[model samples]
Target chain A: MIFAEQLTKSYRTKTEEVKALLSVDLNIPKGEMFGVIGPDGAGKTSLFRILTTLLLADSGTAVINGLDVVKDYAKIRQQIGYMPGRFSLYQDLTVEENLQFFATIFNTTIEENYSLIKDIYEQIAPFKDRRAGQLSGGMKQKLALSCALIHRPEVLFLDEPTTGVDAVSRKEFWQMLQKLKSDGLTILVSTPYMDEAEQCDRIALIQEGKILMNNTPENVKASFSDPLFAIRSNKMYQLLHDLRDDHLVQAAHIFGEDIHISSEVINQQVIIDALQAKGHTQIQLKQINPSIEDVFIKLLMHTESHEQHS
Target chain B: MNNIANNQREVVISATNLTKQFGDFIATNAISFEVYKGEIFGFLGANGAGKTTAMKMLCGLSTPSRGSATVAGFDVSTESEKIKKNIGYMSQKFSLYEDLTVTENIRFYAGIYGLSIPVIKEKTAALLQQLNMESQKNVLVKALPLGWKQKLAFSIAIIHDPAVVFLDEPTGGVDPITRREFWEMIYSAANRGTTAFVTTHYMDEAEYCNRISIMVDGKIEALGTPSDLKKEFNSATMDDVFLKLARNAKRIGD
Candidate 1:
């Protein structure tokens, strides 16, 4: 279990201050897969660092498994596994050596917690003699995760674990996480990719050091308040420009080959006529559901407008 | 922005049996494809599927062990110098100098391509204005947002008006809005007769390409327009098509 109240942190440089976390509040239940989604510099990493007791928050408080992150840093470190965005494993050391080193740090042996990491560690066991640095992106991640779980931590903190890996590797890594979650480990992951948010049981969408929305992916998408349509034509590039210029369109963005538009005026005929008038042919417009990315973009736009108004 | 229909476009890149081998390993196994001018071509594959090796050969960064190819109308093997002059490349790693100002980066890239000082100044001014970041021109590259830096890097990559541009995972880790805006820039460039050769892990991005090639195990498993590929594979999305092809990969996650 993880709980935080009004967490805040700021980094002050010579010229100005950067607010990394602004009153970020989080409550992740035991055995829940919680995701924190945001863009770069949106404070996802800062929150992870604060909660993992690696960095001190300037204000507020956080507790992991009823242990204060600041006061019980040593105990918390023993109970939670933290995987930073960057791979932190010893590259020159063999895979088996890295696991042994981590196990020793926690005053435990790999045999004691072998069951907890068997599914993952077994995949890379054949290459136990190979140095970690020579492993592929996916293998390196698997190795890092194996070390993270060498002590059988109760909670796992993974920061952008699938960021640079290939698609298949990313899929495999998520499958591994699902297996870990099924085994009753509380997982807190952060990523910028919107699609990955769907994999979480619940996600908190953070932006500009603030939480915009927190709910199930279905609930968040169900909250979209406009009539959305996916419009495509022979001339997609021109259609995008035309849609943006149209007064009836409220928000228009390129989603794949089609333009996803949220409009107040929902008459399909009106749009078809307008495009016809613009010499567009083979035009296809149909009402469609809003994806999580669409919902997030709309929420972001709403937040910007509210900021501008206030 | 114009569509720039692909039917009448000229071939910007042509390859036949392009191959690269490392001792016992065949990184690129006789891959062949064609790219049209003023079109966005997506090159996709799983890790260790030979996508990078094929891209390097196309960009003139790595030589092929066998077969032959032409990029920007120059032989990839013999006229690598000429090919390099006619193409621009931007990778996922931010290529701009972090310590240099935004304007300085533009100037440095333009100078490398042997552009006149006057042209560099004009292009830099136009780029800054186009990005609407004229005020940040004097700021160090490290100070800008990730999205802004990516856009600037892309603009600088094509600053010399190359015949084609190659982007490797250009939108990785960027926010949705920024990614959308980046694609808008790509579309605009394609509209201006700059062919785009891109590789992305994002399937949604693959859908935006005029045509796509899915490579698996050092060979192209599928190649066609997005719609045609989906139809041929009997899949509803590019992601599914990719999975169907990549599922047969011999070296998954290598």
Candidate 2:
């Protein structure tokens, strides 16, 4: 279990002050997978660092497993495993050596907590003699995770664990996380990818050091207020331009091959007629449900415009 | 609307039996493909699947051990200098001078391309206005957000107005909205007759490409329009198609 109240942090440089975290309030239940979703420099790293007791927050408080992050830093460290965004394992050492090092640091051995990371370690066990630096991206990640879980920590903090990885590796990494979650470990993960947001039990969409929305992916998507449509044509660039010019369309942005548009009225005939008038042929328009990316984009746009107006 | 129209487009890049070997390792094993003008071509593969090696050969950054290829109207092996001149390159790493201001970076790159002072000034102003970053023109590149830096790097890459551009995972680690906006820029460039050769692991991004080639174990396993590939594989999504192709790879993370 983790709890935080009015957490704030700021970095003051010679030129300007950067507000890394602004009143970040979070409550992650025991054994729940909680995701902190945001772009880079959006305070996800700062929040994770504060909660892991690696960095002190400027104000407010946080507790992990009923242990204060500041007052009980040592105990909290023992209960939680923190994987920074960058790989922090000893690259020069062999995979087995790295695991042994981490296990020794926690005053334990690999045999004691073998079950916690057995699934992950088995994947990299064949290359136990290989240097950690020589392993592939996916293999390195698995090794790092094995090292982290060597002491059987109650909670896992993974920051952008899948970033810059190939699609298959990313998928595999998520699968591993799901297995870990099934074993009753509370997981707190941060990533900028919206597709990964759906994997978590619940996610908080953070931006500019603030939380925009926090809920289940389904609930967040269901909260989309406008009628959404997916439109595709032979001339996609032209179609995007024409759709944006239409007064009835409130938002028109490309989602993959098709343009996802939000409109005030759900009139497919009118939209088709307008595109036809614009000499766009082979048009396909269908009302569709919203995804987490759609909701996040809408929320982000609203926040930007609100800031500009204010 | 139909995939047939793509066949009639002018070919900007063509390769036959492109292969690269590192001693006992065959990094790229006789891969062949063609990219047409004014189209977004997606080159996709798993990590260590030889995508980067293939891209380097195409970009003239690395030489093929045994193969023949033509890029931007020049032979890749012998006329790489000419090929480099007529193509733009952007990678996942922001390739701008972080210590320099926006205008300064623009001027610096323009100078490298031998642009005159007036032309550099004119283009710099237009780029800033087009990106709507006039307010941050004097700010240091490090001060900008990751999304803005990516967009700026992309714009600067194509500022030379090359015939084609190669982007290696250009939208990695950015949010969906920023990725969407970056694609809008790519679409605009393609509209102006600039061919795009991009490699990305994002399956959703693969859908946006006019055509895609999926590589596995140093060989291209599938190549077609997204819909055609989906139909051929009997899959509904690019992710599924990729998994189906990559599952047969003999080597992973090599």
Candidate 3:
């Protein structure tokens, strides 16, 4: 549903330049749940802003639903539901009023799109009389989503929709998104949460204005080329600090109580002795599968190494 | 594991029959929990599930309609001033002055928390060094990356050396790598005996906490260590555990 070719965005300050997005190429299939996973300045928001026709790209071309983002800005806006990272709703207005206002802007009534957003709208409908500002963060998120979907757009662009929400609400929100996807709406979501990346049918791992990898979550995780281990001891805090400082342990960091490590030197016994010497007794070390987060961490470490070598 | 309170590990914050009502709607149902002296306690729920309302009460920003909460040994209802003095907060948006330089913003927040000049200087210097962003201290807050800004905001929030630090989704829009780094900072703070009460929707992030309370429909539905919750919910992951509890969707127990 969305295609971009060498797209880029740059902002010129008085003193220097800020390249928010670099030359990027992406193709998202229609009705697919696509996720853009990245850190803050990885250009996820910039890409969304450009694809939704809210911001202009510095270079390259992007086409949404076969219409050029720059040439068919209004048409793109009409067909896509864009919920920005920030809450951009009428705060003073009631939940129902905000929905009505957004519906009115699209020349549609809330009753018309009521069926589309029924699941989400129903939760906030209890507080329909309450002002948007008075509602909690999760309520505002649902209301904003209802407003976005009120027009029954073909594609939904949710920029970090689950951020700052509670765990239950986050799960509930994703369920709503899944239902929307099953109903044949092209869903594009950007999130910093690595676990949420698995929820998407496909995801593009982005970092520092560049796409590191783009594929199915399973395939992306499958590409991890490292021997991973989870180690822990009574002195977990001290052990973690010591492990990270060890030369044999690459990517040594805490994951829960266990310290996740890459067997960089491949001398397990030597590493264990080093840990024992560091006063980390009763240490438990076991080979483990890499999680999506672990895979990404390894990828980042590899990229850093490649950069240093180059 | 259920009632570790009597062990006397020094409970910093304790709640009894904590309830908050806005008119007929109960924002926080009758709930009670305790936070240890140095631990990261995660308060999680759907949006509008009363996480912020409960947080507001803990931060002394709002009063509970019923129940009682003692934060840093001060009554949340009566001794709000003392409570505020001992606790620092960083919201999701992380309200820093964009127009001000990074150093200036830190100084401003430090002043608001009633810190001395020498203390502020020492804390700022140590914070910048720890974050490895000392060179960017003179730059305006707007010029830094969102990750750096979030880290700085967190650094400033706890700069007062408060007893408790409440972080409401402090790493919301940052990247996964940065989020991991952010959690590192949180862990360090918790290790120093500062109770970190955090609220977030990310389930994996929830797993990182020492203990998490899952809220649904204005009430805490589940609370335990991640592993225990996962096992109890018969789920392999935190996400499944959350979905199972949230849907109220008919579990073996339910």
What CAPRI class is candidate 2? medium
Query: lDDT per residue, candidate 3, A1-310, as tens digits?
Result: 9999998888788978877788889999899999998777778899999999999898999999999999999998889999999999988999888998999999999888789999898887878998998876678889999999988999999999877665666767888999999999999999888878989999998876788889999899788777888886766566767876666676786675467888655567988899888876777888888877787776676666324421
Query: What are the lDDT scores of the predictions, listed in order?
Result: 0.89, 0.88, 0.82
lDDT of 2 by residue, A1-310 (tens): 9999999999998899999999999999999999999888889999999999999999999999999999999999999998889999999999999999999999999999998888889989999999999988889889888988898899999999988777887888899999999999999999988888999999999988999999999899999988999988878898888887776488888887788999667788988899899887888988899989899888888776334521
Candidate 1 CAPRI level: medium
Say which candidate scores most in DockQ. Answer: 2
Q: How close is every model to the real structure, measured as TM-score? A: 0.97, 0.97, 0.85
Each candidate's number of clashing pairs is 0, 0, 5
Native contact recovery (fnat) for each candidate is: 0.56, 0.57, 0.42
lDDT of 2 at B12: 94
Estimate, for each residue in B1-254, the C-alpha lDDT of model 2 and write its tens digit: 12225446888999999999999999999998988888899999998889999988988889999988999889999999888888988887758999999999999988887789999999999999888899999999999878888889999989999889999888877766778889889999988989988898878778889899998999999999898999999998889999888877779585
Please list the residue runs of candidate 3 whose C-alpha ends up more than 4 Å from where it truly belongs after superposition.
A74-79, A89-153, A264-269, A302-310, B1-8, B21-26, B62-68, B216-221, B248-254
Please give the range of 10 consecutive residues that has the lowest summed lDDT in model 2 chain A: A301-310
Could you give candidate 3's fraction of true interface contacts?
0.42
Instruction: Note the DockQ of each predicted structure.
Output: 0.55, 0.58, 0.32
| Cα lDDT of model 3 by residue, B31-69, tens digit | 898889877888887555677789999889899899999
Clashing pairs in 3: A39-B175, A40-B175, A138-B47, A166-B45, A169-B46
CAPRI-style docking class of model 3 based on DockQ: acceptable
> B26-102, model 1: which lDDT tens digit per residue?
98999988888898999999888998889898889899999999998999898889989999999869579999999
What fraction of the native alpha-carbon contacts across the interface, defined at 8 angstroms, is recovered by model 2?
0.57
Tens-place lDDT per residue, model 1, A95-136, is 999999999999999999999899899889999999998998
